[model samples]
Target: MTTSRLARRLLRPPGVYAPQLDTRLLLGALRQEHLVGGAELLDVGTGTGALALSAARRGARVTALDVSHRAVLTARLNARRSRLRVRVLHGDMASLADLTWDLVVSNPPYVPSPRARVPARGPARAWDAGPDGRAVLDTVCDGAADALRPGGVLLLVHSALCGTDATLRKLEGSGLRAAVHRRAVAPYGPVLRSRLPWLRENGLVTDEQPGEELVVIRAVRV
Candidate 1:
């Protein structure tokens, strides 16, 4: 099989978070970094290991983290099948305290839900963040500076509905220089389409447009 076709086929298994436009979007920005092969990289919330695998393919020393058991297993399988050495771990950012990386990338659970608290299990755990959609995003921003080496870079992607300005302010407050590196409009997926009424009711969506703006935030620790 051709490389691209094989890559698409090996991407995900049942019940794992499939790589979507957000994943592709992050990878797109990553390519712009012109990262050296030996760079230490971390992929947080690494669904299906797509981003992690991409970096590994480019010769990065990659460590991937996911809260879901299935995602961890899937990522490991993909890594092994592709003959790449990715350290797949099952935990959140708190679990990586002792290690530091030159670059950290994440496509976290940023969908705003009606619930006040985040889910611990089930498919919702992959995407159903709290009401304002910044639950896990906040968690990552809180410790990203500490998780990086000096001069490290953190690349993260999420919806604009979660407040791009808020993410920038939080990262900057934590002592990192941050900015929105890219923005793209994506058609609402099943999750957002189902929440249209609730989103509109909450004023998260101002018009009938069936699209959401996604922003890739890049933060650097100097």
Candidate 2:
């Protein structure tokens, strides 16, 4: 990540997890592809406002939404700190107001652990994606088509262990042509690893799968 990006991430409130590599990578990709610029953008699950701020910096009119009130406040504070204009709202993906965006990006809760431990101060809607880890992703995939304008794009991040194949299928089933634009493997972290057995028992993970690796999937709304 560039120094500016790092600074922006660090400016977020203390409780928010600083933007991760996947978030930076997606933002970089958006800039490289010229997919964002003076367009209306919506960021779902905009924790710490990484993607939202990045888009705002790139001249996009951004609306960032999170189900957690703290996250919304944190994101708004972060946007002000960064001196970027972004409208931060507290809402779920499905309940977002009727508005069309030229680009939609989200780093949603795709962890598949049944008992995933998250920061007590963090938003439950920011983590915990249900047993299969597809709850939030499913909502985004289903809602994106209607939320985006023609030739609009939707970028998402998730874990490889959470059935990447099925995720792509769901996106396609929702009438969005999707692709894996970037991927990286990192430590699964202690909390997700500790809940592995429960995840497997609940059919969230397979016995053959290891407890690491997250896949960042970026899709375009056709």
Candidate 3:
């Protein structure tokens, strides 16, 4: 099934993030990589297992992890409906520390928010990263090296407002060579639209800005 069709068919209940531009961007980046059959792949923060399903479609041995139980169920349901084999797990990414993959992909919570702490509940958990928007992104970058096998690849997509330079620095510091693999401009969604005033107050956006720039950062462990 095509990515768009798969996305449309996903069972995204309330609070489980719907597949959007960021998800599509990450999927595109993932498609660019050579996914050999049986190659282990991990999708962290798998919302509805869109990326995981995409990888699984390519014959990658895919594991999808999500901190939200609802998301976990949704992903598993989507996988079943798609007739795709994806190991969907419900838990924090840290819970899978013992496992490593040939590819790790994430389109994590990354919208900058006024909340001092990452939301433990609610729909915000899907996008409201605290303050500078690196709450989950930082963790993803830090864990990339350990999550990936030698010479493995990491594909991460997030808002450019979170600072691509910061992501590159973190990935490189983690011993992965990283660069922006793809970029696209997309208008802010309801979450960002609602937070526009706060974003302006925080100087994350300006009055004249058009939209957020989504970037897919691809890093490889050398």
Candidate 4:
């Protein structure tokens, strides 16, 4: 079966983040790395075990982490169904600070929201990242350096609406060499369309902005 099929076949229930454009972008960047066998890897905010299963299929020792219990279960079930070994964990990235991996990847919540705090429950938890959209993004950047071993790599994918330069700066400030590895432009989804006014008022988007730009950021702990 193809690697993409692994994601397509996964079960995604309501409230769990489903594998989408950002997930596929990160997966492409991951494939570019050509990870060696048994390389320790972690997929932060792993929704549906797509990225985790992709890496595991390449023989990487993979651990998939999510804040949602339902997501965790879905990932576990997908792994079992695919006959892939993944250490699926139910928690945010901060919870696994003590552990370091050869590679870390995440397609985290990066949508700017009107709410000051990220949704603790419900489907919004999958994509809403507070007013600036950096609530989770910033946390991921702050913890990324610590989450990787020396010489390890980090592959992260998120929307350009949240600030690509901001993400690069955060990653660099954390002591990792970072840059945009790949990019793709896509039309606004339902979530973004629903809050167009809020996004515009916040200066995250201009009247001229046509669609969302997704980017894959690659960082290495040297």
Q: What's the residue-level lDDT of 108 in candidate 3?
A: 91
Per-residue error for 92 in candidate 3, Å, reads 2.4
Instruction: Provide the overall lDDT of each model, using Cα atoms, as 2-decimal numbers.
Output: 0.90, 0.74, 0.90, 0.90
**Clash-forming residue pairs, model 2:** none
| Span of 10 residues, lowest total lDDT, candidate 3 | 1-10
lDDT of 1: 0.90
Q: Write the per-residue lDDT of candidate 4 for residues 2-111, one digit (tens) a residue.
A: 44564468888888888777887888889888688789999999988899998999999999999989899999999999999999999988888899999999988999
Residues 47-67 of candidate 1 have per-residue lDDT tens digits of 789888889988899999999
Arranged by lDDT, best first: 3, 4, 1, 2
Residue 150 CA displacement from its true place in model 1, Å: 1.4
Clashes (backbone N, CA, C under 3 Å), per candidate, total 0, 0, 0, 0
Task: For each candidate, give its TM-score against the true structure.
Answer: 0.94, 0.85, 0.96, 0.96
lDDT of 3 by residue, 91-198 (tens): 766899988899999989999989889999999999989999999999999888998999899999999999999999999998999999999998878878999999
Whole-model lDDT, model 3:
0.90
Q: What is the lDDT for 149 in model 3?
A: 92
